[model samples]
Target: MPVREDKRGQERVWETRGSLPEPMLPLPFTVRKTRKETHDTYTLELQSESRPGGLAFAAGQFNMLYAFGVGEVPVSISGDPAAPEVLVHTVRAVGPVTRAISGVKPGDMLGVRGPFGTRWPLEDALGSDVVVVAGGIGLAPLRPALYQLFRRRRDYKRVALLYGARSPRDILYRRELGRWDKRPGVDVHVTVDHATEGWGGNEGVVTALIPKVEFDPAATVVMVCGPEIMMRFTVIEFQKRGVPSEKIYISMERNMQCGIGFCGHCQLGPYFVCKDGPVFRFGTIETFFGRREM
Candidate 1:
């Protein structure tokens, strides 16, 4: 049995290679649904052909989506954890692999290799006020965490979501946001960097919406996912609000060539983003975060 040690030095037995499928081998997944979320983004709903049921994944974990000959890239699992029957990934068409992945229509086949990496610390956040902050396409990864929070809404106190997009047309889940905003005990605030006509909502960075959410700083647990600059400033804002670094978490992006840690492309300092994290408690990585050349 292979053992994996977490940042805290706790060791857990990972799967034995004999019982599980090879980690690097791609499993066939058919695209059952694909829809445009924005001008450059698409949400792909896939179902495994070889594996029955669905791919089980936790919030903030990602998959290595391969576009056949074009290659593969890391995309966060964006669907509800409870309904893993339809494996979902929100892809931004920024590179060759992503563009190919997003171009696939219904009935097309793609390769999927993982439900990998660290997950949002939702279990530890029970009974605490949960605040979710997202920027641009970063909203995709945090969507699952939001779904989990709402499913067990009674376990948490004062749940809130603050999201920022590049413009009014760039928001990822417009209909869902509207519905979440109406949920009792949940506060959903949205902002756009550049507002357009017919947009009457707030217009500013997401950090501006922080104050609008009421939470006890000491009892609040925050999850942030966005560009590095946006995450950096969001952490600063939360720090000023008195939230402890250990109580705040953030997701990171890197050139992850392998889902496992064998490939060092996703290394950040002593940790491997692909293995140790893509989600990390703020204090754990604060030393190198936002530092030049990191």
Candidate 2:
């Protein structure tokens, strides 16, 4: 049996390859703890049994999470690489699989497949201003990029994050966002589509907040992740502000069954969304952006 250790100092027995009929990828991991950040959002802290080594990935990469007998889903690594042993993922309970994940307890066993997909170009953004725009639960993948930037604060120029959700209560990573707001070189602006009583923040579509940001188009990279419609409008807005199409990067979401390229479920035209990217330069994917049935 393969044993996995968790953050809270507990170990669980994981079935080894010999115990199963076919070979299995036994990535020994333990569920450290589960915490609810909001009414429906939860974060899981997973610890690796071995002394964790660096996960060589650019920011914005995602991993395939496998529940013992349930199913698998692609989730972003929301933790920083600076501390690799303990991995963190912020998940929202929207469906059966995710709800099962949310129900996981400390010391539970789970499997992980990758740190796959094309990553956000943090190196390209070096010395250039960055504009990160997120909508709804789309902020999950962007969290890695935010973590990387703040971890090495001097690598990039001014950085700003514009996030939007249905209501103030729906916002994810409220605690981390609060810390980002207080950071000297970062500006975090948030908005809601509808306002509830006593809400004091801006109330409007996320695009409405873009006009207030100050960044030179020629020296900035805009990274966006959101609903297809939201991204469409965001690209248009960036164009109006003189930001080149090539400079804008966007993370696309699709029904990904397998993290590897073998699955056809995540195909987009000639490119496999799982292999080629979940993140792509806007100009590289503009043709498929408006397709009716992508």
Candidate 3:
């Protein structure tokens, strides 16, 4: 297999002897641990079937996990890149593929491929004020980036997190979010579109909590992830507050087939979301991102 590093970061081409490139091939992994995040979603920790340390990925990258004879789907690594020996995936059993994958218990085997796609701009935002906004499962993809930012808290000026969910039950990591919120120099603001009987905080939308967090719009780097509509509105809110388009980044979720850009299923205008992104500058995708049929 020919190896090359292109726009998609380092490429690890997997090939059989005298055969075509098979980067999409899966490697066996055993489930190490499992914890239910909610009534329907659970976090699964997997380890390489043979080696303790098989692969390392950047904070925001993902893996295509295949259940035995079931199906496959891309799940972002929710754990810190610093501890890559254990791969953590928070899975919501919302559909057939996910249900099949999430049903496996400890010691069940699964196939894994890729530390694929672009990563969160943790390094680029090091010296600037950093703000992370997440919605629902979108937080899974940003959790590692947040871990990296918090690991080097002194390198940046200010760090804040604004998150929202449909309801209290839909929140992914309640305890973790609380712990991070209590840390020095770290601020977290959480809101929900719908609330429970005991809910006591903000109650409109995530954007409602934006003003509550402290950050300078011009000097801040904003990283957002959620539904496309939510991301679009969040970007608009930041732009209205003097944040430039370049410093604002969004993680784009697409129907990714071939993670290395061989397939055209994830095209976004002129670029492929799988290879060119999953993470992109807001200004880069601003044109066709929100169009109804683009």
Candidate 4:
């Protein structure tokens, strides 16, 4: 097993041939709790006695969760990295496998395989300004990164989060966003496509809120997660603001059949999204990022 330290000097278990005998094998994890995040989204808290200390995962990594006989899907770890005792995943019941996983009872067991892919570069962004942009359900994957930044607020300068949803009701973590906005030195802005009754927030694309927050583009690191088109425009917006493409990271999702890149279902140009990244620097994939033909 290869053990390495991230920029924070925290030991992390990088999955390797020595870490496990079978990379495809799934371990049993008892579903501890489930919470309805929205009309179609559910957050599951899973526990496994097989590993008492819990799953050590960085912010932007995902797990190949197996729902018994149904099959598997890659879900990002949405919980705080500091509290790894209970693994948490926010799942949207959009497909058959996800529906099965999200419908599981508290005592049901789900097979868990990995904490794979690249992570948000929080350590490298230390002492710089940080901006997070999320759209719709895309907030799930970015949640863990926000937890770490808030936990160590003094390490960075200005911090901001700009999020968008279809409507106010579609907001994922409403309460937490309120709390985050109250924190000193942090700015949180939210918008929706449609303005429903009783909704008083900004009503537009997330990019419109970008100008509302203040940050030094030269020293800012921006992390984005959203629909492909949304991310494309986000990168363009940030670039126009003078944020370099190398400082902008985006999380992507594809047809990831094999979590370890054996199947090549998630190939993006020359990079295998499963092995190389789910989080990639915007400049690296600019050519094929928003192309449907890719």
In order, candidate lDDTs are 0.88, 0.78, 0.83, 0.87
Worst 10 residues of 4 by lDDT: 10-19
Q: Each model's TM-score, in the order given?
A: 0.95, 0.88, 0.92, 0.94
lDDT of 3 by residue, 254-276 (tens): 88866778879889898788766
Model 3 TM-score on a 0 to 1 scale = 0.92
lDDT winner between 1 and 3, please give it.
Answer: 1
Residue 147, candidate 4: alpha-carbon lDDT: 95
Winning candidate number (lDDT)? 1
For candidate 2, the TM-score is 0.88
Pairs in steric clash, model 4: none
Question: Can you tell me which runs of candidate 2 are displaced by over 4 Å?
Answer: 1-26, 54-56
How well does model 3 score by local distance difference test? Answer: 0.83
What are the runs in model 1 whose C-alpha is more than 4 Å off?
1-20
Can you give the lDDT of residue 25 in candidate 4? Answer: 91
Give RMSD (Å) of candidate 3 vs. truth: 4.0
Q: Please write out the lDDT profile of model 2 over residues 204-266, one tens digit for every residue.
A: 999999987889999999999989899999889999999998899888888887766777888
User: Can you write out model 4's per-residue Cα lDDT over 45-125, one digit (the tens) per residue?
Assistant: 998897877787888888889998999999989999889889999999999999999899899999988888878888878
Q: List the residue pairs that clash in candidate 2.
A: none
